[model samples]
Target: MLLGRLRDPYINYRHRRLFHVLRVSIALTVTFAVVHLFPLEHSSWALVSTVMVMGNLPHIGGVLDKGRQRLLGTLVGAGIGLLLISLPIPGRGVQIGALVAIAIATWLVFSSRQAYAGLMFAISLLLVIGNGAPDFSVALWRSADVLIGTLIGIAATLVILPHKATDVLRFMLADNLDRLARLYHAHTSATSAPGVDTRELLKATSALLVKQRGLVDAVHREGRLSRGEVDELISYQRRMLSTIELLLESHWTTREGHDRINAMQGLRDQQHSLARDLGTLAFQVRTGQPISTDISPFELHSFAELAVGARGTDGRMLFSPSGYLWLNRELARVAASTAQRLASLERLPSKRLRRRAGRHGLHEAQRLDSKEGSQNDPGSH
Candidate 1:
């Protein structure tokens, strides 16, 4: 009941924002107190480092990543700063040139996955060596303060209103599958408006898939999902989306060819059936459970054939019935492949959301409860 209550308000955008605001406020307050408590010069760096770690990423994975980059950058920059201070440079110009070179090298790596690390490295270097006095003790203090602030940020993120990436990813993936199912039904429905603009919808779905890339490591660490399993799931899902896009085409054939294509049997019903399977897959993904029965592929009969070499006597490749048939088969193969890949996942029990919370996920709870009852029944025992 407590979990249910927490989730209800957490689902609200305003409430989520409030949670983050409170998190940052609490973390900063503690850091401020500590800064005043210490008898060190340049203590303001602590507060700055805390905000740097906590400002953008509210999710656990993102915070962990930012915290790691900040710590690494601070340590490396401080070490280099100490080394540079000891070097017998000819003049201030040489020192300045060396700093510039370091800055340029760091900025060049900003386009890679370690982009944040590069920025943090540059900032750390500047903090350590940029002050008028290049004192070794001052550099050590700045590095120490930065580390302290980063640790505080990480602690606050973990203890106060933490949003684990695994949990977020589960919600995201389930929602994606459900949304795709809705799109499938809408696009394939007989009542769909003519010339409907589905481009935006497709673009949005693809964008969500891209967002999943960051959370991949979270699942690996928290859910123990194998890299290959994650790749297959993502790859097949992409294939499914691409297949749907290809299915939206103007027939490259003559009137007779178009008629033959339209005459294909059971395409509409088959679409609806496939959408249902997609919905089921969404449920399974949310709960981290396998379906009792396997999701079967579309029957070959549904793939209606067109006449061989559909061209008007001019030898133009009008409507390649074979190509049309091949696409349908590809769609079926992809859909089936997606289900099979999902089923193949070696999901750890710990990965399952056992909480009977939230209206959107009640089915998983109810089903699990029923299964538990069966397991404990006296007659069964």
Candidate 2:
């Protein structure tokens, strides 16, 4: 019951919202504290921008990235400022050319994944056009100020309600496990249309990859996940996602092609099932006891048995439409794999098995209660 509530999509969203709000609040407090304490009379605009940028850093990795950008931008802008100040020629042409070069550099960096390069490029340009102080002094002051702000921002981000990337990684893994369960449900229902929707499955798989990237970035920033562990987790996620894609597209081919594809699909489904089970087992290991299985791919056997029983019944059949036996065979392969995953998990300590079974029993009870309520309802008919 508790695990189901934790996994609830609506509950997940609420937690996400609360986390975001907390991060924002911390950033604001840090910005105000810095501004009041330092009281820099001159470059208030620059200070304000730095505060805004620093305050919204959602994760440590992002904070570091912005800091790097600010540093690079300051140096480049400062160098330009010095050169322009030293130049005997005060021509507008020279200034325009310098500005253009800075713009090009910024664009090039921005094209890459370093989002902070644009700011750095702009800062470099600003330093080049200093009003009173020599370009070197202006550049020095600007760089120092930006560095101060960046440090303050990073400090605030790391200190305030500090979160571990590992938690996010676990959350994402849990979500993926849930998605896998849904996919199995879709497969066994016999209602999933003859051809699986490759696009929809791929979209979900792509989102998983995005989350993996986020996990990597978060760990890199906070040192929350070990490098080896991050690599292992990411590699596992990518392999599983690719395998799922292959399976999704396997059903749409010629007869000879179908047979070869079906064999591959069998292996693919088995791998997915094993992976999901391992993930569940890992969670159990982490949480000190095996969580009860609220959802099980193995239970999908009931659906598969129903399909087999419906075979050869005619066009009015309830499951696994023909001309699609190859597809159904592939699905059976997937079910077998799912069963293997559950079995592997069961082989762990008996305590885990008991806990998992206990959860499944609870879910079954709830399901029965729901059915009874529906049957009793006048509107149900």
Candidate 3:
């Protein structure tokens, strides 16, 4: 009963949120325990470091990446801090000049890609110089605390219901492919309204493209996916998006003669066949199953012949089919290529599959529940 209740979508979302809070809390607690046991000076810094490093769930990769950056920054800052403290210019004016110079340099660094390191450098400089005399030991201790806290954050992420980047990437890829299938169905369906808003599909694809970049970065940080695999996934997604855009353009350009295309038995049959094939491939991807369909080349030659021979009531070409055949052929080719890539991906061994299986099981249970609900409804019957 507890498991069933946890599987409820609202309950699951709350649990996920709570899980993240627990992970951070545990990390902070551990950091504090160590600091108190060792009687470390400036222990508050360690707590701050842990809080900064512990990100939300399903982003272990991001947490580790930030931790690495924090360590690197701390080291660079400590070095700079020590050097500034050791300067031999004994006058107050010289000290002020050094401070001004360090501030300007740190500001420049903060604007660069190594902004974290730059900020750390500035902070360390201030901490070291805040004392009446320059103390190199202070800089060292601060860096050590930051490193320790970072390690603690990383440990918390790995120990707590660890979320792997690979699984998240797989889920996102499957969801995006399914969205593409829906867009394709809408575009190709004979019954779809001519004035249907296609921009929504384009907007969704564009958002997915942006998300793909972030996921790729996360995977790279986690060091789970090889360079080749990353390249292939990114390339495949781009091609799919391009094909979707082409299909949308074709639909819009041919809107004036949409009735004629729908009326033609061959074109209608081919369109439906292509849409079904796409949907099947999408399902295979979402379920991590090997794709087995051999999509026959869209009968482009026949389509061209019919398009050229057809005439309207005014005895003119029914539509400007200039790139219509090419677009259809390209969509089929891209879909086939995407399916082949997904099939290859599915054959790879995944360590996160067991964890993902639980999520998939919940999805199945929810589906069953919805089916039962509908069956029990008098309106549905």
**Number of the top-ranking candidate, with lDDT as the measure:** 1
Q: What lDDT would each prediction earn against the true structure?
A: 0.66, 0.50, 0.64
TM-score of each: 0.78, 0.55, 0.75
The predicted structure with the larger lDDT, 1 or 2, is: 1
Would you give me the overall lDDT of model 3? Answer: 0.64
lDDT for each residue of candidate 3 in 200-223, tens digit (9 for 90 to 100)? 766776786676676665567777
Count of backbone collisions in candidate 2: 6
Can you give the lDDT of residue 8 in candidate 1?
38
Off by over 4 Å in 1: 1-16, 87-90, 93-110, 131-134, 193-200, 214-232, 251-255, 291-293, 301-322, 347-352, 357-381
Error of 3 at 381 (Å): 23
Clash number by candidate, in order = 0, 6, 0
Weakest ten-residue segment in model 2 by summed lDDT: 345-354
Cα RMSD for candidate 2? Answer: 10.1
What tens-digit string does per-residue lDDT give for candidate 1 at 86-195?
A: 66665584368447757775777757656777777767777676643558788888888889889999999888776666556666666777667656666656555344
Estimate candidate 2's alpha-carbon lDDT, on a 0 to 1 scale.
Answer: 0.50
